[model samples]
Target: MTLDTKKNVFVKLGKFLGQFKEENCIKNEAVFGNDLFFEKFIDLIQLSQSHNGWYTPEQVYFSIQSWADALTEENLSQWLSHYDFSKVKPKKVALILAGNIPLVGFHDFLSVLITGHDVLVKTSSNDQHLLPFLANYLIALESGFENKITFVEGKLEGFDAVIATGSNNTARYFEYYFKDKPSIIRKNRNSIAVLNGNESKEELAVLGEDIFRYFGLGCRNVSKLFVPKGYSFDSFFEAIFEYQDVIHYEKYANNYDYNKAVFLMSNFKLLDNGFLTIKEDSSYGSPITSVFYEYYENLDDLQKRLEDENDQIQCIVSNNLVKNSIKFGTTQKPNLWDYADNIDTISFLSII
Candidate 1:
């Protein structure tokens, strides 16, 4: 199919997704194929948590809404406008997706197909249902898509290139396994926020969204904090107190209890606020229900350190205190053009 044909199909998929909200799922007759797929989609959303405890309805709905907002005609045009697709000789692009958060690998899936290439998707065991469901929807929107998308159950072969996302360990294996083929192998990375003690209570409160959204499973979730020396966390703790309801979730509560016990047994000093714990750690990746924090004496020195270790970080959230940092609370609401790990997928695909 042509690029415009592919784009129009996804735009329709976006419109269908827009009907489902956290509060309600309102059906619009104008959305194509809703009569067959709409009710089934709702059922799938409801059943998501049963399949994977992390895939709660609220989290799934948030992911759906985010993609709905992203796949608009305008957003797709802006993201794809920078690439010249004439030179893209259609090839089979294999995707090995990660399932830490709902629909975590959709961007790669969309990227491959929209560029006029066939896709071989091996869905993460934790997220096998949602994408296939949407793939079926896409096929319904355009019968031609049926020929372009395939879900592999065994060994992945017949693909020219691969894009794999996994932990640091898996990345090593991916590098060796796909050594001969062109590939993008993603490793574990974490997001961090820098605090200057000048942020408003409102901004701090919003930062809680960055911390708690998707239960901190996403690479975009702020898992660490950089605060100046002698920084008082009273306001920060108070602002984030609104998210205490997270502790009511059994899985999260179990993690909070377990991690807290481990820390206590190790005699690690911690700042506890009933639900979340803040520990003075030099590391970026934090466990669930907790965030690691480090004290910085100089913004310039800290920026330099972060730049030197850029591969370990996904995003830097701040009040523009550091160069190229994103604003508070917007880490999870990334635009279509915001490529993960600063790697341009389009450029990579264009070459391969």
Candidate 2:
């Protein structure tokens, strides 16, 4: 199929997704194929938690809305305009998806297919349902997609290249196994925020969205903070208090209780706010219901350190204190063009 054909299909898929927001899922009769897929999609969203406890309705709906906002004709055109597809030859790109958050791997899936390659997906067991359902919807919009998408349950093979996302441990296995193939093997990375003690309460409140969205499972979620020396946590804690309801979730509460106990037993001092805890540590990756913080003496030194250790970091959150830092509260809502790990997937695909 032509690029416009493929793009149009996704635009339709986006419109279908646009109907199912967290506030209300109103059916739009103008959307194609909704008669058969609309109600079923709603049921799937509601039941997603059964498959993965972290896939709460609120989280799933937020993901849906984000995608709905992204898959527009204008956004797709702007993102694709940077590439030359006329000379491209279709290849099979195998994707090993990570299911930590709802639809976490959708961007890679979209990238492969939108670039005119066939996709062989190995969906993470934690996220088995949502993508396939959307694939079916895409196929319904244009029968041509049926030939381009495949779900692999066994060992992945017969792909010209691969894209895999996993923890630091699994990434080693991927590198050794797919060493011969053209691949993008992603490893564990965490996001951090740099605080200057001058942020307004409103910015800090939205920063809570960055911390609590997806319960801090996404790589883009801020898991650590860099604050100035002698900076007080009073205002920061007060601003984020709005998200305390997250503690009501049993899974998060259990994590809070367990990690808090472990920290106390280890003789580590913690700053607790009844729901979330902030500990002084150097690690970028923090557990759920908690965030690690470190004090920095100078922005210049911290910038150099972050630059030198870029691989371990996913994205930075700040009031532009660091170069290319993402604004507070928008980390989880990445643009279609924002390549993960700062590696351009389209450029990689174009060469392959």
Candidate 3:
């Protein structure tokens, strides 16, 4: 396709996705029943309790809005700070997804669709409703969309490039299998925060959203925190206490109890709010095991620690760190320019 074609694709997609409301996406994601949109997304996150690849409508809304916002200059700029966009282009692509997080594969799907390439996607069973459901919604947005996209459940042959996401272990498998193909193999990554004691009740409230939204189950979710030595966990805990409503009955209760029991059985030291466990560790990504937090002596040490662990860092959710940086509610939501591996997604699409 030509540049005009690519531009037209963007025009159609923007118009379609721009007007998209939660209700529409709710219908798309639901199997049946009253619009359980936010509830379903919440269930997904609650189910994140078991690493079952779920999400609730509220979280999905946060994610989709983040997705919508990501296409433009605002969110994309922070991403572009580290990537080069001049080389992006559309290429025949195959995307294999990870079932760990809700719509973990959608970023690759959107990149392929918006970049003006034919996309063959294999959905993760944990989130089977996502890409196909999103495609159904995006395709219905306009005529060209219906024509531009295809849904492949298993696998596809003939591809110039590949984009796949999985556990670090699965990433190794992806590398060995796709070694000959130009690809971006996204593996496991953990996000964090370096609170400098300036956090107010309002900011901590939003941080509460970041941690609990998906039950601390996203790559962008700060499974850990980096506070100065002797940092007060009380400041953060007080904010989390306000969200006491999220812990009602059945599944979430079962998850809270099960994980809590495991922690008790193992004698793992933890700071508990009767809902979340703030344990300290150096691991990335929460496995429904427990949320880990760490402390740093100063900003320089924090920067060095993150830099040294760049391979394991996905995103940093903090305020007052940089001008246009991400806040708590915005984690997991990525912009178009925020390409995986800091590579320009659109430019890559335009090139090979």
lDDT of candidates 1 onward, in order: 0.95, 0.94, 0.65
Candidate 1: the clashing residue pairs are none
Q: Which tens-of-lDDT digit does each residue in 186-260 have in candidate 1?
A: 999999999999999999999999999999999999999999999999999999999999999999999999999
Root-mean-square deviation of every model = 0.6, 0.6, 5.8
Pairs in clash, predicted candidate 2: none
Which run of 10 residues does model 3 get worst, by summed lDDT? Answer: 25-34
Q: Kindly provide the TM-score of model 2 when superposed on the true structure, using C-alpha atoms.
A: 0.99
- The local lDDT score (0 to 100) that residue 314 gets in candidate 3 is 72
How high is each candidate's TM-score?
0.99, 0.99, 0.78
The prediction achieving the highest lDDT against the true structure is 1
Per-candidate clashes come to: 0, 0, 23
Q: Residues 111-136, candidate 3: write the lDDT tens digits.
A: 67655677877777777665565566
User: Residue 69 in model 3: shift from native, Å?
Assistant: 4.2
lDDT of 2 by residue, 291-333 (tens): 9999999999999999999999998999989998988889988
Give the per-residue Cα lDDT of candidate 3 at 20: 40
Pitting candidate 2 against candidate 3, the one with the higher TM-score is 2
TM-score of 3: 0.78
